[model samples]
Structure formats: C-alpha cells, structure tokens
Target: MRSDTCQHTAIIGAGIAGLACARALDAAGLPATLFDKARGAGGRMSSRRLPDAVLDLGAQFFSVRNATFRRAVEGWHKAGSIAPWPASLWSAQAGRWQRHEDDLERLCGTPSMSAVTRHLAKGLTVKAQTRIERLVGSAGQWQLVDEHGEHHGPFTRVVISAPSPQAHALVAPHDATLAEACEAVIQRPCWAAWALFDAPLPALPGVDDDWQAVRVNDPRLRFVVRNQLKPGRQDQGESLSLLANLEWSEVRLEDSPETIVEALLDAFQQALPDGSRLPEPSALGAHRWRYAQPDVFAGGEAVNLDYRLSASGLSLCGDGWRGPRVEDAWLSGHHLGEALAADAI
Candidate 1:
C-alpha cells in the first residue's frame, strides 16, 4: 500500500465522519474527494436560520469525554468555531443535579453547528448535491454513478462514512463482505426538533432555570433545551428557541414534516405552565433523523470487516461503526484514516 498506489480515495457523505476522515487523509498527504447528497456539508451538525437568529436543528449539544475529542474541541474553540454552552442537567427525578459555571463543557458551534463543518471544509474538494446510486468495480478501479447515471471516479479505494443503510446500499454490489458488515449496524430513527418563539418562555418548576435544559423521561417528552440561553447565546437578546424529543416524532417519522412540527408544538405547549397563551413561534421546524443514533454500539472497533474481505483499500467508518456520539464519529474517522495511511505505507 504505497502512497503512489493510494493515489485517490472517495469518501461518501460530508457529515462529521466524512469531514474528519477527509482532514485525516489530507493530513497523511493523501488526496481524496468527499461526496454528499445535501446541498451543503454538516449532516446532523445542522442549523436553521430564522428571521433574526439561527437555531441548531440537529445534535442539540455535545460533550467531549475523550482526549482526542477534547483537543479537537480546544482547536475549534480557539478558531471561534465552537463555544461552551453553560448548561446544567435538569431531570424530573434528579431536579437540577449539577450546574457547572467554571468548566461548563458542552460545546456548540457558533452561529450554528453547521459553521464548524464549513470551517473544516475550507480548501477541501467537496462535491455537494451529488448522490451516488451505485459503486461499480471497473478495470480494477471503483467508479461511482449518481441517480441520473452520471459517472465519477476511477479511484483505488473508497471510504464510506455515510449512515449504515446508505453505505450498505452503495457498497453491497462491489463488496458483499463490507455490505454485510454494514447490515449489522442498526440506527434508530428520531423525531427531534427546534421551535423559535417571539417572546421569552415561562419558567417551569424544574424545566426552566437560567438555560432551560431538561431531561424528561415521560411518555410525551424526552429532552428540552432553550437555544437562546445556550452557552454562546448568553449575549444574544431574549429570543426563545426550544428543542423537543417527542415520542410521536419517532413513531410517525414517515408522516409529513408539517404534521410532525404541529404535533411537537402541541406537546411543547402542554409541558409549559401557562400552556395556552404561549405566543406562536416565529418559526417551527422538524428534523427526521433516519439514523439518529446507532441502535447497537460497535464498541471501540475501527472497521468490522468480514474476514474474507480484502482490507487493502476498503474501510467502513461512521458513528454507527464506532460509538454513538459525535466525538465517536471524529475518533472513528481519525482511526480509519491512520489505519488506511499505515496500510498505504
């Protein structure tokens, strides 16, 4: 696996795993192309723009428990890409368990989580709005075809960092072993969201504190966060945004987005005290994460390839393949990059 032999690598999906893999490959002096179906990067590390402010629609907040992830968060902090959200855990049973003012660690990207990916994508060759329908092995090289049958790439190796199901579809024909490994990875669908308000929201007993981050295990609510009171939002004036993890969202994921938004808004109102008069939100949005979190954690494994599959230039990497969290995605990508680089050398 020489550097010249590994001339090109094709990475699928421009989410955290894909971006992290691209950065790691570039750092190893390997040229790679990143492809994503979205118009822009940052899958799950997403945000929605309202009239005056932005709301984080996916991945409400993340904590760095791993050393590698901590260092990366530090770099993002210095670059002004991410900032600490001074948050305390409020649970129905625990009741505001711990509040850390000194080292409040949960971090979110400034402006929005998507900004972090935009910063990382700088100077990288990213192909957006490009969907890969299939991967074909032609003339001893891999070729990617879009839905319209447009072909791209005759590369030596391909790294799929998309969700497990999507990755399985792309690589199944070319590499059955890898595809079967992907089939073992299951992701849970989540109907989570962001709701923006015109006026300040009322403070619930244990729900709304300084920041209104609550963990409700009731059948109706899962988690809630006040976006305005989030870490970087201390200075931003009183614009209220709420994130809800609704059970119904998970149940009726295939339903229309408008229907989901309305249902979640109703649940939100019920959770509040003055429930009825809460001003109609300036904007309401719903996000359906088909693979929100991995149903089964892959432990600390790098690539769970089938023994029969050749590991020369193929790898599977993503949050589902490694651990569940965002940090796990980053670490998994970094691990896969190092493994590929080592094999290349």
Candidate 2:
C-alpha cells in the first residue's frame, strides 16, 4: 500500500516455500506479490475441516534435521502451532513395534498441517486462484498472464514455484536449458485417504503398543496415524483422524471416492480386533497427487533458474528445481528473494 516504485517480484505458488519467500522479501523491505492457483494457502501442507474433526491430507508430519528448520520449529512450538509426537515403527521386516523414546523429536502442525502454513503466511500479500498462464518479457519487464489471458504485471522479476513439469512448460519456450533442467527433475504420484472416526478403536496387533504412532507393514498400508494420540489431540478426545498411506490409495486410485473409502474402512476393520466397532466416519475423502514427491533429490544446488530473458528480468523457482518437501520449496524461494533483493540494491 506504500505505492513504492521498487522492483516488483512475482512469486508463483502459495505453499510453504512461497509463503516463506514472501515473508523473507517483506522482511528485507522488498515489494513482492505471491500468486497461487489454490483457493487458499498451504499447498502440500493442507488440512480439511470435517464434521467431527480437522484432518491433515497433505503432509502427515515433518521432522527437523537442520538447525534452521529446528529453529523455525521451535518458534512454531512457542506459538502453539506445532507439537512433537512419539515415533513408532511399522516396517514389514520388523513388524509393528514402538521405538524407544529418544531425544529426537518428530513434529506435526497443531490441529492440522495447514496451521503451519497459515501461521507462516501471516501479513503476506497472497493472491489465490490466480494462475499464471504464460511469461513474456517485454521492455525489460516480465508479463504474467492468467487463464483468461489477462495480464497482471510487468514485474521487475518473476519466480515460478510450481512443480517441475508445469515449470518446464512455462519456461521451455524461452530458456531451453532451464526448461531441460526442469524436465530433468522427475516426480512420483501419490494417492491418500483421510478418514475421521467417531470412536477410539482398540489397538491392533503389530500396531502402536504405547499409543503414539502406528506403521502398518502391510503392502497396502504405508503409514497410519491416530489423531487423538498425537501431541495436540489429547484435549480433543474421542475424535480420531486416520491417514492411510499412498501405496494402498494408489492401488485403488481408479475406484470412486465412495468405493475407495469403503475399501479402506474394510481394510481397517480386518486389520484390528473389534475394528468393526470403530465409529462410522463422519467424513471420508481422497486426494491424488500427480507429483507427490521428487524422484531424485538435488543437493547443494539451488532449485531455481534465473534468466535475463535475452534482456528481460525474469526468473523461475519451484520444487522441481529445488529438492522435494515444504522446506526445500521455502529455501529455494528464499534464495531467489535474496537474489532479487540484492540485484535491486
């Protein structure tokens, strides 16, 4: 609202990385506009509001391995946005078992994963449901168009934070090498099922003995989480949320949502004793991620392409160039934001 004439940086995608970029740019005293095609913030770190409870459909949990991420997680914990949960294992080789409590901490967004993204996006300018159809360099500026062919800005710089395939489509015509790099980043699809149960079903054999987390070794079951057992769910008692792994969901991807839900419910019943007594779900849904995870990881390399557009100021950033995960996307965007800010200076 300051009407500052500083270089306008356009960032595509409102996921963790995009929000992080926006926050970083604002802190650096730079003007930026964050665009996302989704209706709201939180791309992969998404949550669904059910009739009974909130469900996390995107990232089940996030662990902090790096100092920077750890510091960020600590801040979130202080803000009541995140909490640590006990870790358990469900490997086919080891069977269902609880790992000894260790100093290591596994964290999850409070209530839902979206809580983390929403917290991070605070005070940021985000334009949702706005798609960037194409990028054209004109007179040293970059023009971004929406699906309707309406152009938004002749931005001083542009950063695309979409998936690799989409990013390749956007930049291939202009920068062949950058497009090639984007294409080189392969992604795998994942399907997931989220169910809300009414009752706290009895524990199953080879499942969580300590009531923490459960990993099912069945080929159909990748990871299973009981919401009530999570760090912040103790107060929410009786309302349990379950997240089924991608392997099972992928096998039933072609099935209708209702069919998939039924199959999952049946599987759940068969896996646990008196599982049939589990509460009838108040809500059931499934999501298909065409590019769920990066096939190969990029290490010590920036997952972004900065192009002068043969004379224009434009750049592209996204998970495809960066490594996978919410953190990777955020770091890449931050890197681009810093680069743009430095160039403006």
Candidate 3:
C-alpha cells in the first residue's frame, strides 16, 4: 500500500535504471509504481529460459565502477542475487586468441541477468505488459494512457526511464527542454544470438575448458559468452550467447532472426583457429535490441547532471543520459530518485 501523504510517481520502464530509481524512492518512503511493456521486468538485463539452458540475450555482464553501485553490488552478492562471471576471459585478436588480463571485476545476476532486476522489483508495485503510449492530463496530475486504451494515474509525477528515443516520445508534449535533451542523445542497435549445443565447446590447446567468454574482434561478432559456464548455471547444457558488432547489427537491423542466427554462427566458426570445431546446436534463437546502448551522449559529451527533472513533474533518466555501462544506468536513475525525494522533503 502507498502512503497517502506522499506524492505518487509513475515510472515507465522496469530495467535496471527504473528499478534502481524505484528502490531509491521506496527507501525514502515515496510512492512509485513501475510500468513496463515486457511480460516481466529486467529489460536488457532479462534472460530467456530454454528447455535445458538459460541464455542472457541482453547485457552479458556488468562491472561496478562507482562506490555507491559497488556497495549495492556487494549487498546483492551477499543476498545471492549476483556473482562474478566469465571465470576465464579471452580476446580474439589478429586471428589468434589471447587471455584478456584485467583487474576489473565483472558481475552477472545469479541464475540469470534478470535475477538482479527481479530482486530489485520485489515489494514494488509493477504493472507488466503495460505500454504507456502517451501522457494525459496536466502538470501536477499526470495520467498515463496505455496501448489498450487504459488510463492509469493521476500520478503526481511521471519519470520516463526508457531509452532516450522512447523517452523523447513520452515527454515531448509536456516539456520541450526534456524532449530536446532526450533527442540530443544517440543510441545504437544490437543483435544477440543464443546457441545451445549438444556438447561442450571444443577445448583449444592453450585455452582451458573453463574459458567462459571471448571478445571476438571480427567484423560480425563482438562477444561470445559461454552461458552454461556462468555461476548458478552449471547444471545446464553447453550454450553460447553471441553478440554482434554494433555496425553489423545496425546494417542488418531489419534482417530476419533466422538470417541473423545463421550469420552469427558462421562468424563464430570463422573466428575460431585452425582445427577448432563447434558442437552442433540443438536450439538457436536471436533477438534485436533497437536501442541497445547509447553511442553518443547529449551534446556529444557526458554532462554534469545525471538526470533531467522538470518543474512540470516530468523527468528522464537512462543509460543514454549517462554512459552505456550498466553502472551508469543504475546511477542515473538512483540520482534522479534521490533528487525527487529531496524535493518532496
């Protein structure tokens, strides 16, 4: 139940950013309801469950850079919501594989990337499969109209945590400055393919069987993750999540999934060294993220403000406003929520 004294906030999108914002607001005793078009939360952090394997088709893994996010990650790790991933990492450079040596620690949600967002979403009111088409009513009393012609709210404020393009569409009518800011940001598309193999990947001479991920510097393939090797997923069969390069994905954005799956699989095979072979895929799937990540920040550079909060009770925050990393999305929304809560006080 919501506190009657607190102003109600309607948050659109249930990805990491939205959930992070909601968490902050909830901690401050603010009333906020999340709305997402997907069947459940997690947005890019969501996962797909196969018959015997789980694949992360969106963000494969994230690294914590900010101290605030590092603390949150620590809490999640203690709660068993996330764990370090890619026990081994490699990079395919000049047609040869080399160890990716880095001191940075990367984390992925336990079981799947969605677990983190799902954990954040607990106890928070969320309306799934509710795609808010436009904002209705006036400032100080905003209403959300969904695709089903359903009107929700009389919300005191509406915060759009969608990608910059989508957020622009929602706030254009209410606040020109917010819309312009959203418009200034640029995003890119991506193609992710999942392949479940009948057998584990063939081990290389120098690479260990535990080699979990590789950065393929091929023209077509950017990343290939051994999904089954991730923590909390050892029970599953061998599976791989193949992410295509941004340029390749953008060129073939409208291509069919079947075409993409085949292309990425071919690219993966080609990226392998001599005598290396892959097991036959038992199942294959592909997904296209129209706004996968922001390519350029607003005004061609990162700004001082982490988010945009208008006097009209309209606001915007997402990966575009910050950097493309997962930490940026969370911080953008977290700071926005903190600002809103402070205003109410």
Candidate 4:
C-alpha cells in the first residue's frame, strides 16, 4: 500500500515503446516512472534462457529504416547492446529451399533480445512485476491500483504503452476519444516455439551450413531462426526458434504449451527438404503472445500519427498507434514523450 504524492509521469508498461518514451522525457528534463508486470523490461523483446540454450521467443531481429531509429541503432551498436545478424537467409516452400536476399540490415540485441530493452531501462526508475489493474482517480491527479489492490499515485499524467486491447480497457472509463482510438486497432496472436538440438540441422540442397534463417511458406510455421548463428550469442548448441503462422496460432490460442511445442516441432520437420531428417531435440518450450502484432486499423486507413494525446493528461503510444515494427513502437512513444514535455497533453 505504498503511495507517492510526487509530480511525476506514470508510464504503464516498460516495453520498447514505454522505455523510448521515458528516455525522451528524461532527455527533456522531466521525471517519469515505469511499471511492468513482467520480471524485466523488453516486453515482446524478452528472451528465455535454458541450461544450454538462450532462445529468443519474440522479436528475433529488427531492421532500421528511419533516420531517427537508425541513429538510435547506431548508438546501440556502439554501446555493444546490439549487433547485425542473419547474413545468410533462405526461403522454404513445399520443402523446396532457395537462397533469399533482401539487402536489408537487421540487428538483434547482444546475447539476447532483452538486452536492448535492458539497456534502455538502465538508470530509469522501474517497478517490475507490478500489474496496474486500475486507474482510480480523475483529471489532474491520478492514482494507479495494482492487481493486489495496492494504490500508487497522485501523478500529473499517465501514458499507457501496452497492447491496444489492454490499453483500451484502461482508457474506456476516462477518455472516449483515446478509448475509441485504442478500440479501433486490432492485434494478432502468435505462438513461438524454441528447440535446442543436440546437433546441427542438415543443410538443404545447394544451401551452405552458414544459413542462419528461413522464411517458410507453410501452413503451420512461418519463420525459423538459428539462435546459435546470430551475432553475439554463445554456441551452446543448435538452437532454433520456430514461429508459427498467425492464423494457425490464433485458432489454437488456448492450446497448452506442450501441444504448441509438439505442433511447431512437427511443422519444422515437415518444412525440411524431402530426405533431410531433424535431430532429436534436447530441450523444447513454447510461448504464446495473445496480442502479438497489429492486424488492422478499424478507424479507416492506418494513420501516420505516431501517438495519441488527450487533454485529460492521458496519452497512448505503441505499435498499434503506428506500425508493427520495433521502430514504429519506439517512434510512437518517443513522439508522445516529446509532446508531453512540451505540455501538449
């Protein structure tokens, strides 16, 4: 039941977007506090560590397209928090493999996907494992209530960087405009499976052993990446991240993790070339992201606006407000933080 009566900005969610917003505010000489239900930051960028494998169950790699994000990426690269990955790519369709090149520079967090968010979260005040279930007060003075019924607030403003559906629930009772905006965005689900093999996978015909990733046009699996091949990762074993197709995952959303792990592993085997056999995995696991990516913008065409700000000191920012890329999430929060610093919200 601890409470704070200070004049601070309360940011709900310590993901990439939320961290970006907090950083922007900090640079502008404003104080903000971040809260997250997870044990650490990174949100979708989080990673899982096993006895011999470090698997990235979400956001395998991110590309830099915009100048702002590019600049940030450069800094991260210099700071050793991120590194380029997947220099070789392959595409698989009906068990046919071919070299795929897109000329896009993709980077992943060093050691694990969560490193980037951890770097962003450094020096910032964060309350981890705190699920803010309710916004209790009104207007200028707001209070946040967690799932344990613990109250923590009296903040000047609140910014929600969670997924669209979760954000909608919090804003519905306060601001209709923000609520409707959140409601208009739909998020898709994804089931990611990780497997650590005792040995390397067999190379496909005409494919080199250095091939690190694959884009599969299969009904069950969509993308697969070799964790050990990625830059800055220790070669504990042949680790693979199997990402299931969106529609396939959505239909089996409630399925148990064991079911998902088995299904995705079977899918990966089917995706291999005709005579190639997959080695027995030493360890396996699965993670379900109920709200993984933005599916559609029900409010007509997708808007280019990076964020949404309300006059009631409530603001919204995330990939749902912009696009699905990690860059979009960062931009959304960064722009909103700037606006708030200028007293625009």
On lDDT, the leading prediction is 3
| TM-scores, each model vs. reference | 0.86, 0.83, 0.97, 0.95
How much RMSD separates candidate 1 from the native structure? 3.6
Give one digit per residue, the lDDT tens place, for model 3 in 1-345: 433465999999999999999999999999899999999999999999877888999999999878999998998998899998877999986458888988898999989999999899999999999999999887779999999999998999899999999998898887899988988898999999988888778878677778899999889999999888898998998889999999999999999999999999999888787788888898898999999999986521255787888999998888888889889899989999999888887
Instruction: Give the clashing pairs for model 4.
Output: none
Model 4 off-target regions past 4 Å? 1-7, 298-303
Q: Model 2: per-residue lDDT, tens digit, 1-345?
A: 434456788878888767776776787788788888888888888876655566666677776666766776787889899877655533322332444455656778886788888898888888889988788875347888889898888787777677778777777777776676676677766666667655555555645544555555554555556666666556554443344555555566667767755665555555454322466776667677767777664432542342222234546554555566666666666666666666666
lDDT values of the candidates? 0.71, 0.66, 0.90, 0.87
**Tens digit of lDDT per residue, candidate 4, span 1-345?**
214335489999999999999999888777899999999888999999887878899999999888888988898888899988878888988788888988789989988889999999999999999999989778778899999999888888999999989998898999999998987898999999998888778867768888889999988899999999887776578989999999999999999988998998888788788888888888888899999999874321155577888888888998888888888899888888888887732
lDDT for model 4 = 0.87
Q: Which ten residues in a row have the lowest lDDT in candidate 2?
A: 303-312
Clashing pairs in 1: 1-344, 85-231
Runs in model 2 lying further than 4 Å from the true structure: 1-5, 87-96, 100-103, 138-140, 205-210, 231-253, 266-282, 299-312
Q: Which 10-residue window of candidate 1 scores lowest in summed lDDT?
A: 92-101
* Candidate 3 vs. true structure, TM-score: 0.97
Candidates ranked by lDDT, best first? 3, 4, 1, 2
